[model samples]
Target: MEAAAPPRESRPGRDWDRITAIAAVLIGLAAVLVSVYTVLLQREQVRAEVWPRLDFYYAGVDGEFRVSNKGIGPAIIETVEVSIDGVPVRDWAEVTARLGLSDPGQLYSSLWGAVLSPGEHLAYLIPSGQEAFAQIRAETQRISMTVCYCSALRDCWLAAPEDDGQVEVDACPVLPPERRFQN
Candidate 1:
């Protein structure tokens, strides 16, 4: 028989093969961990950036406090529920009835200017000074606003509270109107 080359070493050295296999497994595990971490981080960022919150100066006017939506995000004013000293105003029902429409766009168009998109924008008027109205003062009243809008991804975050008080379009801040709402 032709001299068979000494049987080639039957296999790679056990030490070297074991080390290589372990390294590969570690690398794969590390990649999976990194991917999961990245996804979680992205979700957190999205939650932080999506909504708009507005702070406004409420003053007594016409024997009532006039509260306006100073921050924007296609503010759903109809859905707004105002409270004075933790008491919910019952006049909102009358206001809604007078509005004659349930939608924000229609409500805005009926009032002034034109329909607006999600961002820092003006809102409907609330008259203060009436017993039902919150006491008008320089002290800031905590206002919680909620609304919904579409993203570039075409996904709707409907009626969701914007956590950071920021209204954004493609991740850009929508500036509040320079002229505050009066009356």
Candidate 2:
């Protein structure tokens, strides 16, 4: 009779190989997750580098009202709304006429569709003398201005003379021709 074959021993190597494969898969998954996190962080950093902030400047002594881009990026003025006693005015002429101020022959710049670069300013309204300035400043108590602007990345903000600072907005509202400020 042939001798019984020795019982085959369990192969420990096979178990080790299975464990190693599982470990490799886990490591690969972790690497992919980290890569995704890194990419998201980089995108936020880029947005910050191009963020824009628009600031309103009112100089009673200088007789000027200006809008400036104080951030590192450019600001695209989308719409400018000038109101008196909560009523919208179509243009600077209307604002002056309503305020009962004679045209002082001052210079003014358009705000709609204008782009303001960093550190650049646009004098929206400039009175010719301190007398006009004083009158306007006094009457300005009842006046309010709203400017909606966007950055290169399409991030929008609403700035006003009354607000302490600009407020982030989802988007600027589209105004009709009659409601839009002409200057």
| Tens-place lDDT digits, model 1, residues 1-183 | 798778656664577877999999999999999999999999767754543333333334433322233323333322233333443333334333333323231222122222234444343444323432333222223333333334323233323232534344432223234211111
List TM-score per model, in order. 0.40, 0.85
RMSD of each: 11.1, 4.0
Candidate with best lDDT: 2
Residue 25 C-alpha lDDT in model 1 = 100
Write one digit per residue (lDDT tens) for candidate 2, span 1-183.
999999999965568778899999999999999999999999888778777887777876678988788898889989888888889999887888889888658778899899998899888888878787777878987898888999888889998877758889999989988779988
Could you tell me the TM-score of candidate 2?
Answer: 0.85
